[model samples]
Target: MRLAPVRDDVAGFDAGEAAAFDPQPVRDAGGSGERITSLTSWWHTRWCQVCGHTFRRGDRVLVADSRVRHLDPTLDCAESGGGRADEAEVVRFTEGLLATWPVVGDVPLTRTDDVPGLLAPPLGGLRRAACLFCAHTFRPGEFVVMCPCTPAARVCARAVHRDPARGLPCWESWRPGSTLKVCPVTLTRLAT
Candidate 1:
């Protein structure tokens, strides 16, 4: 459907007068990695090779070397397509991995000029056969891994989800009038 052209006299157009225009309030997802006036964020959707789970824009997930593919169709780890590994197989991959390497969550990546290759697209590309969720950035003759993670471990994804109880889009930049930061779960109970 075509919308009426907006007028420069928007200030004079009150609610009833603008009804024919079908105006929509501006939205700021804030977490969509938009490059606003002065700030920019980097967040992208990725798939979990181990569980075949597709993570959304801001989810935190584990990553491992892509050379090793995990998660068979039956939810078991496998070195290759034909062979299956049991629960212990996952332990082999995820166990001491965290003890030695810290878990890296999905955070926005910004370009840095100081790092020789940080601003360049990952050398092998974001999806590489040898890398899980990310590719590689090289300096001179060496390969440098980007912000890293491992799929062998699980990180809770609840924080990445929008508030389920309120079912409202993000309002970090919106202030219709007055707002409160009350718990929606409690508000639901009080309503009934």
Candidate 2:
């Protein structure tokens, strides 16, 4: 989708120092094996692939070079008149797939960087919640991850600290063992 970082001071991708980032292990994860550069947004908005929400200004996002193509009646259905059927099949499959993923009730912070804006304080319409991993209330601008577990396995769709750099490695601590990588709450297998 060609999204740039949402910083007012930065003019474009070249203006900011780009770094390599591993793609989040999500469904249909897109990104070439090559090192990808993150761009700063001067002007433009994009929908978060993980949450499907609009990206606010000043939000730092990691974007991959990928495009989702929709089948067109003339280009695809013309060959077999299967556009409608194909579209319906795609929709049904998507719905079924999404049903299997984590069911966080609120709009989730897709990346650690988005926590500042999405989880801002009351003066900024704060979202009051606690981290499932450590049981501590989340402070504004803290890096966190909304528990990406199935509804039955989640403890109120909690948010947990994800940034290890600042000494809060709650997310990394949640799933301690390498045994199938299940959620700690109910041992339910995580989608990603």
Candidate 3:
């Protein structure tokens, strides 16, 4: 049985190890005091599945899972040596972790003013999110990034660059952020 890891990260983790700084989200007054934006950042180490290399920052590497699995069907993902996984499964795993991982950040103040309601969710105004790299849809488990650039922009670090001419669809790039960074695969698809 492929067990999904039990997790406490979706709610956000403490930036510091001290119990004093653990994320104890208080709901906003204007918005439901249920969800507050996380001030923490997200990141993952770059590793080569074939070579076992832990890449340093700014190293040219596969930054998205989509690109990784697609790039070489024979390559076992750096962490998946015990089993074989298909492209869909790999992408799904990446997507799930990105969505559920509790961020390490500060609790945002609840808005007492008119906070914009998300137009798409069945929950009336709950934050809606998508992968920054692939634009895959997800309902945010963490408070979605509501930057002035896009009030409802949900993001992930799974980015890729496309190479349509060479038939290399996309490759992972780097860390994710609150703002969307549409994958080249999607961009190429949209351009057509």
Instruction: Give all TM-scores, in the order shown.
Output: 0.18, 0.28, 0.17
Per the 3 Å backbone cut-off, how many clashing residue pairs does candidate 3 have? 11
lDDT of 2 by residue, 1-192 (tens): 534545534655434444324333324234522212223332123433333333333333343355221122322211222223465565465445445543234423334345453343334343334566665445433566665454334353556665443345665576443122576556777565
User: CA lDDT, every prediction?
Assistant: 0.29, 0.42, 0.29
Per-residue lDDT value at 75 in model 3: 30
Error of 1 at 9 (Å): 74
Instruction: Indicate which candidate wins on TM-score.
Output: 2
- Cα lDDT over the full model 3: 0.29
Flag regions of model 1 displaced more than 4 Å.
Answer: 1-71, 75-82, 103-192
Tens-digit lDDT string for candidate 3 (1-192): 533432345323443455555657443233211111222201123334343322222222232432221122233333323223465775566456545653223312112112233213324443233323333222112123333122333222222222222221222122223223443233422111
lDDT ranking from best candidate downward: 2, 3, 1
Among these predicted structures, which one has the highest lDDT?
A: 2
Q: How close is candidate 1 to the true structure, as a TM-score?
A: 0.18
Candidate 3, residue 48: the lDDT equals 40
* Candidate 3 residue-wise lDDT at 169: 22
> Which residue pairs does candidate 1 place in steric collision?
62-150, 62-151, 63-149, 63-150, 63-151
